[model samples]
Target: MGWLKDDVALITGGGAGLGLALVHRFIDEGASVVVLERDANRADSLKRKFGEKIETVVGDVTSYEDNVKAVETAVERFGRLDTFVANAGVFDFFKPLSEFEGPEISAAFDELLSINVKGGLLGARAALDALIKSKGSMIFTVSNAGFYTGGGGPLYTASKHGLVGVVRQLAHELGPKVRVNGVAPGGMRTSLSGLKATNTADESLETMEGFEELIIGITPLRMSPTPDQYCGPYVLLASRENAAPMTGVVINTDGGLGVRGIMNVCGGEDLSA
Candidate 1:
């Protein structure tokens, strides 16, 4: 039998990248998924590919009403809600704080925190009762950035760090009946493009050639995983039988990257040396 057989999963940002990977994995493992996406086109594409096995709702994660609708739809369609994954988020453009005006900083902070922080809280709140009834779990899509500095710029890092706190707090508040956990992914490829000028994976590599050098060299595994590889951590967290004692745990599936300190070398030379 599949690990998630008969479970109903609700995933935010489910139309692409890690979210899409989770939906596919969950369905393959026998769970039915309800996807919450802001992009209608992406939702439509998911529906066309997966048919009724997956349900797609196009809405912004930052909206409480949208979160409610997603939960309602999941329970109404699947008979019960078994898992909630708060995976909706955006990247900052790597602009330094000095470059940001007060209004710009406020706007960026609000935008990032609204979707990344408040959105997760909203999803959990909306689905809390159902999860309690089903003894289900809450999972967040944090990043290695949550624990370290290099995964993103300050804004992205702060947002992820805030999410880590959310996981911990929720786990404490909803314990014994409902579990809460997070998955922190490291370097991986995904299309979080065009919204701004934050370094792309390739661009970062070129701008700081051997940018991945320090990370790979320090990691015991010496490799960066694809986005799909991160899905297993979520699946495990969502599985009651597998992760029964794992409440409040933040699984850093970052290929050991988080353990290594951030690279501060200039011109490919270790400054400390």
Candidate 2:
């Protein structure tokens, strides 16, 4: 549906998982994309896959300079930037507070928060002027952990919760010119991994055994969606015509995670005709 026809977007961490999915969705919806990825190989792969329809910038989201470069690339290549999607993130692999040593906790917290939270802040700031000029939108990728417990351990949960606040405050702060919103999607098998400081950098989310079953069993919808299934909200938020009334909103794409039953996780398990 060319919801974003002629629009231009910059997506951080757009080399894999949800980020890669967003890149595909945005382009399919008729938007030109610029991806900021830290991995050189991933950048090369994106270039090969999409050709001139997309631009790949080898950069990290946590660095202000890198964020600026990506934003600049979007503006320079596409003439304007209509959307800035801050989607780069890392996980903590459900390691609870008790599992962490005091020093390790400090180090891991700093690393994870810097990527999951600070990265968004920096990207928004870097794109602030361009977004205002075009009256564009900013879509942040949060998680079910943003609103409820059990989605992740303390570190991951806290980071997502922080994005919820960022969405609200930025929407308020950038009003009348730029729109700010977010998406809180449920479990998806992604390359999302834990912090190096936590010794779980090599552990991707998809490697978590029973993860698919866990999502299917817990949500009221009784299904685990993939990254592509989660791109609609981002597209809506990015669309100037369709989402004109949206701002300071965070769509919960977690298959009714908010309505989970206390006893069974899904109350409709015994539904009868």
Candidate 3:
């Protein structure tokens, strides 16, 4: 039996990248899923691919109404909500503070934070009632930037840090009823796009040169994980039997970044001898 047998999840940004991977993983684990996606084309693709096993809602994560609609669709279709994954977010393309003009910085901050931080809060609020009734959980998709530097620019890192606060605060407020947590995954070769406010809307991480190699070189594990590889932590967190006492936790699945040595990324490079 799967860990999430018969569970129902509503995932924002379920149309692509890590979110799309989660949709597949959740369903494979015996969970019904409802996707709140901003892209019409991706929403249609999900419907065609999953058919009736999943429900797709065309909406923006930054909008409260859209978040509510997604939660409503999950309940109306699947009967109850077991998990709410706030996975929709945009990047700042590593544009540093010095690279932006005064007005541009403000604009980029607003655009990025509105979607990355505010979007998660909106989704959490929308799913609160159903989650309280089901004793469910909320999972936010955080990034390695939430803890360390260089993962992204100021805007992206600050937004993820803000999400960390959201997870902790909500966990404290909804204890004994709804659990809140986060998963911080490191660099992956996804189509993660950038902010239009900084003129990077057309840029995608996949298009960056040496992206995978950079991730491997900087981490102790020397590997570049796929979106599917990061889905296991989500499954573990969503499983009621597995994560009963887990709340206010942020799992760092970033190739052992926290354990990297100061002189070397990994100390066991020649241990086989």
Candidate 4:
């Protein structure tokens, strides 16, 4: 495709799930990427697979220094940073309000929001200079929860909803120099993990039974898209030629969630049980 030929991007959580898929898709479109993955094993694997086309910066998105390091790696290794994708996030495992104690709610909220929302802010701030210099863009990975309910529990839902605001404010603040946008995708069978504070750090979406069926049933399109299938919007938002006039916009790739009428994701079950 080469739509992003010679462009450079810094993507957080590029170790697995949708982040990993973005890495592959971006490379296929002729863009070199610097991945800010906290897992050393996953970072090493990216290097082995993509070789010099990818630069793996092992770091935590919650840390400003680490975010800066990732941005630096993109510029130092690839010469310029054109896109910064804040895609790292943790789920609440659909844990509802009744499922948490007062203190546990605070802890889970802190842990989940720190990575999902604050991490995106830190990454965007770190890459601010580079993006402006290149007249580039930022793509945030929001979820179906950003615009509607039932995608996740309260904590996860709040974070994604908050991201939609971030995409707008930043695009408003940084425009004429840098573009900012977002992509809100629906449920998928990915390695999306949960909060440690809720004793769900090790729980991944792949281990959740009936998740696929639930998503297909809830979505109007009746399809659960894979990570690769969701990469097109990011590419579009990253493309200077295509998305030149677009900013502060969020592309809804949520399997027709915008048109789907009101529905219950878990039905009338006792959530506390």
Q: How close is candidate 2 to the true structure, as a TM-score?
A: 0.97
Q: In candidate 3, which residue pairs get closer than 3 Å at backbone N, Cα or C atoms, i.e. clash? A: none
Sort the predicted structures by lDDT, highest score first. 3, 2, 4, 1
Q: Using Cα atoms with residue i matched to residue i, what is each candidate's TM-score against the true structure?
A: 0.87, 0.97, 0.97, 0.95
Question: What clash count goes with each model?
Answer: 0, 0, 0, 0
lDDT of 3: 0.93
Q: At residue 223, what lDDT does model 2 achieve?
A: 81
> What is candidate 4's local distance difference test score?
0.93
Instruction: Give the per-residue lDDT digits (tens) of candidate 4, residues 96-127.
Output: 99989879999999999999999999999999
What are the per-residue Cα lDDT tens digits for candidate 1 across 1-273?
A: 489999999999999878899989999999999999998999999999898888988998888999999999999988999999999888764556777766667767777778889999998999999999999999999988899776767788899999999999999999999999999887665555322332232232224445456555556556656668888988899988999899998999877664444542222333334
The runs of at least 3 residues in candidate 4 whose Cα sits more than 4 Å from the true structure, single-residue gaps closed, are 262-273
Whole-model alpha-carbon lDDT for candidate 2: 0.93
Output the lDDT of residue 187, model 4: 91
Ranking of candidates on TM-score, top first: 2, 3, 4, 1
- In candidate 4, clashing pairs total 0
Candidate 2 structure quality by residue, lDDT tens digits, 195-247 = 88988999998788999988887887778899999999999999989999999
Winner of 3 and 4 under lDDT: 3
